[model samples]
Target: MTRQGQGFVRHIELDSRVGTDRYPFSLPVVTHLAGMGRLDLDPGVTFLVGDNGSGKSTLVEALATAAGFNAEGGSRSFRFASRSSESDLGDHLTLCWNRRPRTGFFLRAESFYNVATEIERLDEGSGELLRAYGGRSLHERSHGQSFLDLVYHRFGPNGLYMLDEPEAALSVQGCLAMMVRFRELLRQGCQFVVATHSPILLAMPGARILQIETGGTIEQVEYEQAEPVALTRAFVNHPERFLDRMFADDA
Candidate 1:
């Protein structure tokens, strides 16, 4: 049976003194986090949903950093950095732990190529370590396949995972597969905090949806009300009308 308290992180606390007029602090999500004090997380799955530029990805990166994962992506043990584009919000934040995770990974879809390079470097001539990641070079696989392979072969029980825009590399079918994988992980005493725009991912059963409003106000909303779901539903249902309004200014 799963442990009574299965999650690694219970909530996140932002230091009050960390607030300033700096770039990240000036970001609405950071300011909102500072003002609100703490962001509570669900033990199973917590989804961060917002439109572009709403700072949801920034929050996920900070949370992953605070939890000791590499800023660019990968497990806690990875230390490779191609370049730095992350804010210092992680340095100023604290994670409240329900229980420490035995294993975990932070995945940034945009920088996963860097992670693949690092994996090859670590493997060198020996391919033993690659076994955990489907026993082959991630570079050899298609982008979506690599992502799925990482989840299926590398992810394990009692883990904490933070993902940023994983759908960026996935097809609709791939997203459906990922949802199934996520459910399995949840059952295995793993916890996930994902920042995503996929309405499909938001449909995970029992997932908590946290929507970041303009100016960084975070609210717990139902799946249907999530911006991605609502917007995608509207667009799919009435593409012509949506497109007409979207181009109304030009028209």
Candidate 2:
């Protein structure tokens, strides 16, 4: 039987006139999709596949904010959480998720600094928080440790989580552990939207892969057929040959 719509944000209307300058802090936008008008987002696991600076992060940030997640809480833009806005868009977008997330988490690879700061803010009133985060202050724990803890404790069934480049701090084993968690969450009807370069994460079966090209257009493709996955696979399978070709080209 066919499935029904799950109330995920299937479509979004983006206007170029709605500039980020009003947001005060502007994210790096290497690709411009302002002309796309209305773009469709898939309801299930979505892989925003693209090269660095392709504006995947920017688009995801905007969409997450539009979906009403707390910017600093892993689901919204980090900058938005630090600043206050009276704008209707921000207010209205937040209302969408007021009911509670369906199931998911947003992981930003480069925003660990903000995450650290957020933990500190949470510890302000609580004295001696070192014991709370694995017997060390959130700041005292290593970056990887903190990240692993976030995944372990924060991930739950029926939550809509968005992750941005989650592989930045994880080791091979950590990634594998994450894959296990992902499967568990998926089984519980949790949906994930991840922007990542990690082949392991991309290998999650049945994920809907969407490539956001540097040109700002988004396209759906297979994980194995993706440029990132293919290039990564080739290098891993034949690193010596790949390196030789690279050096040969330099020669």
Candidate 3:
């Protein structure tokens, strides 16, 4: 029913009387990665991973959209903490029964420029976002620092948050800092569905990982077992050796 500090993602029992169309799709529900042809996810932290063009972003967008969220909604999907119930929005994507997220945020790492603009619009009313960096616009801050500020100031507990390629600007140490913040939020029952390639971010223990390969469906695996994690570890653990071989004696 519930996972300690985590909220309950109750199971939905579809009634035979309810038409399939009540769901988001005509194609049978792609509820599980294995069913869709990869990984199943628990209600906790679900990481969707794959190479670029592997459809990872597409899947997260669909999930957010299906949950009555706009495709490009940022940290505040349908406004900041405006409404707690989104069930009335209807099916944009098929979901299991009892699917309702108390709060939701979508963080598109590359589209952070848009986030800054959106915040500027809000600055007319409240200067919270601008104040994040002592009155400097997010533009004034480096990419990674700005992202950290957003998560630090925008994120709340008991919410479902999605992140795409958050590693774009974060240095290794910054990523670790983000992880610390993430752990604090997770303890408060916040759930994360992140799409990232950074080995540091992927190392969040106990988070569920979904890997989507080329022509492959999403599948759940341990974080340590992820291809990106493995590859990054190998590279970092022995960079000189690997680099020497990679660019070796080509001279």
Candidate 4:
């Protein structure tokens, strides 16, 4: 069930005038968003899930960019660019804001190494600058530890956060910890937009799972119906049943 709660940006709509025969514009997800005209976000957490190459991450990245975050990842203040491969979809997006947030961050799992490097550069070996990041270099910690510290330290009350595939660095235990932290942050009036395939992360209470279907249609699905949850449940319940089918000869 989706609970109506305080959120920052309420929804996103694509501009109608944008050209259709471009790189990102040609992506099915982009076409769907363009055709649909608008995508509503859950006031608390919105989970985008789909099979690989489905463009869930692309949409999340565009949302982050349109919301004033660095394309690579980090807080709005971060201006570092490891590379410039972002789609122009963000440029045409119109974000409907409930209110402006004092603080926010865009955390992209794929490029967090660059963000960490930037953090270290900004800190310049000063322990004072590292205080906001658990008082140590994110590079010094294990991948999972660094992510944990990000939530516990850098994230705070009334903040807006966009994360793409955060589960990339987490173990099952880490996912659970992040869920607990998410609850705490929600109580503190935070909002989250995340793209993930982790059924565990999708199980966070009251989160709205928006699954990007084939051909780029985005639909709001129940937790049980979410692709990750349904598939993972099936595989765990009977791994051999699935493996056998895979090994069996095609008809």
True-vs-predicted CA distance for residue 213, candidate 1, Å? 0.2
Model 1 gets an lDDT of 0.91
Candidate 2 per-residue lDDT over residues 1-251, each given as its tens digit: 11222525555565545456543223223224444555555555677888886656665655566666665445333333654432333322221222345555556667666666775666575644434444445466677777777666657666777778877788888889888877776666566678888778888877778887654567788878787889988888999998897799677
lDDT of 3 by residue, 1-251 (tens): 22334433322122223234432222222233323322244556677778776656655666665555555557433354332332321232345523445676777676667667766777764766577534667777899888888677667677777778877889888898898888887877776778888777888877777787555555566877798988888888999889889888786
Off by over 4 Å in 1: 1-5, 249-251
Per-residue lDDT over 87-206 for candidate 1, one digit per residue giving the tens place of the 0 to 100 score: 888999999997899999999998999999999899885998899999999999999999999999999988999999988899999999998888888888999999999999999888
Taking the tens digit of each residue's C-alpha lDDT, what string does model 4 give over 10-58?
9999986675787788888788888888899988999999999998778
Number of backbone collisions per candidate, in order?
0, 13, 8, 0
RMSD of 4: 1.9
TM-score of each: 0.96, 0.74, 0.74, 0.96
Better of 2 and 4 by TM-score: 4
Indicate the worst ten consecutive residues by lDDT in candidate 4.
1-10
Top candidate (lDDT): 1
- The model with the greater lDDT, 1 or 3, is 1
What is the descending lDDT order?
Answer: 1, 4, 3, 2
lDDT of 4 at 79: 94
lDDT of 4: 0.89
